[model samples]
Target: MLVRKARLPDADSIHALIRSLSFDGTLLPRTFAEICENVRDFTVVENDRGEFAGCGALHLYGPHLAEIRSIAVTPRARKQGAGSAIVQALLAEADTHSVSCVCLFTRLPDFFRQLGFAQVDRTALPDKIYKDCANCPRIHACDEIAMARGVLPDIAVLGPAQVEERLIPLQL
Candidate 1:
């Protein structure tokens, strides 16, 4: 499969893929407009025949932090390295921008562990907490484990953890 940066035309398919898993919280549901707005943040994988295989995104919170979001491969694409390739592309995207750390909330810790991420206290990602977590219905009882590929250079960059700006409204 060829892994490359995602474009505008790819948004609908990517949204469909993520939405398929969002109902169970395997991924957070995103709207078509939201996907278009963040399309620059994503990288997608396509099979040899050029069909959508999987996608992942690198969302920057600041110079100190970036989060990997919506990484899901189609059922037929799993175990074929499409997911890994998309993740590696997302990591490269972070590195290219000089992000000091890359963090993600996932139940699939082993999958991320194999990609060089280490388990981190959820509090270590204050920006994520300030942004996404505040809107999450499970804030008081989150099941997802937080993981990071690098130490956050400065937590201050994340701002206040307990306060929510509600800057971006998300759909569960």
Candidate 2:
């Protein structure tokens, strides 16, 4: 498999792969427009024949943090290392930006763990909480595990107080 930065033409394929996994909440749903708008954030993997195999995105929250999101592989690409390639590529992208940390919320903790991510308290990622978790439908009953790699950012660019307030009830 070959991994490279996604181009505008890859939006539909990326959207389709994400949509296929979003039904069961494996990923948050992303509109085609959203994918197109953030196409630069995405990295795609292709089989030897150049067919789209999988895609992932590196969402920068300033240099302090970056997120790995919307990663999914086509059914035909499963177990073929497409997913791992996409993730590695995203991590490489984060490195390019000199991000202090990389984070993700995932059901597949073990998969990410093998890539050097360790479980982290959701509250430790205030930027992510304020940006996505506050609006996430599964906030109170979130099944995804929060994980991170590299030094955790000590400063919260978003509202940490508000994030704490919102997450308090979940801990109850």
Candidate 3:
């Protein structure tokens, strides 16, 4: 398998991959336009024949914190290491940017735990809760667990205060 940074042309495949998995509510659905806007945040894995197999994205929340979003491997491609490879690529990208830590919300905590991630109280990440959660349809009834790998710099001092001040206090 080959893994590489995603290009603009790869957005459709990436969107389809995530949409396929979003059926079970394991992932949040993303629109084509959102993918286009954040195309640089993605990495994809392809088989030796160049078929799109899996994808994941690293979303920058601040200089010190990033979130792993839209991670999914094609159902036909499971158990072939596509998911792990995509995550490894995302993590490597985080390292390249010198991000202090990476966080993700997943039902599959065991998968992330294998990658050195530990479960954390979601409440500790007010920035994340205020950004995505406040607008998410399932925020009031979220079933996912939060996890992180690497030591995060104190996010309060890492710029989240600005985010908190701007929060609109939506009821989600």
Candidate 4:
């Protein structure tokens, strides 16, 4: 499979992959406009003949962290290294930006564990919680496990205090 940075023309294929996966609650649904706007964050994989195999994205939270979002591969593409290639490419992209660590919330932690990710407490990723979890429909009922690769940064911006301020208090 050939893994490469996504361009504008790749948006539809990427959107379809994410949308198909989102139905299972394995991924969050993304709007077409949002995909177009963040297309730069994505990397797509295709077969030698250029058939779309899979796609993944690295969402920059800051210099300290980037989140791996929306990684999905077609069933037909399984076992072909498309998913792994997409992730490896995204990790390389993180390294290029000097990001100290990459984090992701996934049900497939074992898959990521083999890729150097370790399970971590949600509290350890406050910036991620502040950005996505704070508004997520599953916030109070999330099932996905959090994982991170690389050492935690020395910077303190995304820690508890910073996140608490941004959280909207909820009442049942």
Give each model a TM-score. 0.91, 0.91, 0.88, 0.89
Write the residue-wise lDDT of candidate 2 on 121-163 in tens digits.
9889989999998877778999899999999999878785776
Q: How much lDDT does each candidate structure score? A: 0.88, 0.91, 0.85, 0.88
Q: CA shift at 34, candidate 3, in angstroms? A: 0.3
> Model 3's lDDT to the true fold?
0.85
Local error of candidate 4 at residue 72 (angstroms): 0.7
Error of 2 at 35 (Å): 0.4
Superposed by TM-score, candidate 3 places the C-alpha of residue 62 at a distance from the truth, in angstroms, of 1.8
- Quote the lDDT for 98 in model 2: 92
lDDT of 3 at 61: 77
Mark the regions of model 3 whose C-alpha exceeds 4 Å error after superposition: 156-172
**Candidate 2 vs candidate 4, TM-score winner:** 2
State the weakest 10-residue window (summed lDDT) of model 1.
Answer: 156-165
C-alpha RMSD values across all candidates? 3.9, 5.5, 3.7, 4.0
Model 4 TM-score on a 0 to 1 scale: 0.89
lDDT of 2 at 10: 98
Steric collisions counted per model? 0, 0, 0, 0
Candidate 1 has what TM-score?
A: 0.91
Error of 4 at 146 (Å): 0.4
- What is the overall TM-score of model 3 with all chains considered together? 0.88
Model 1 clashing residue pairs (backbone)? none
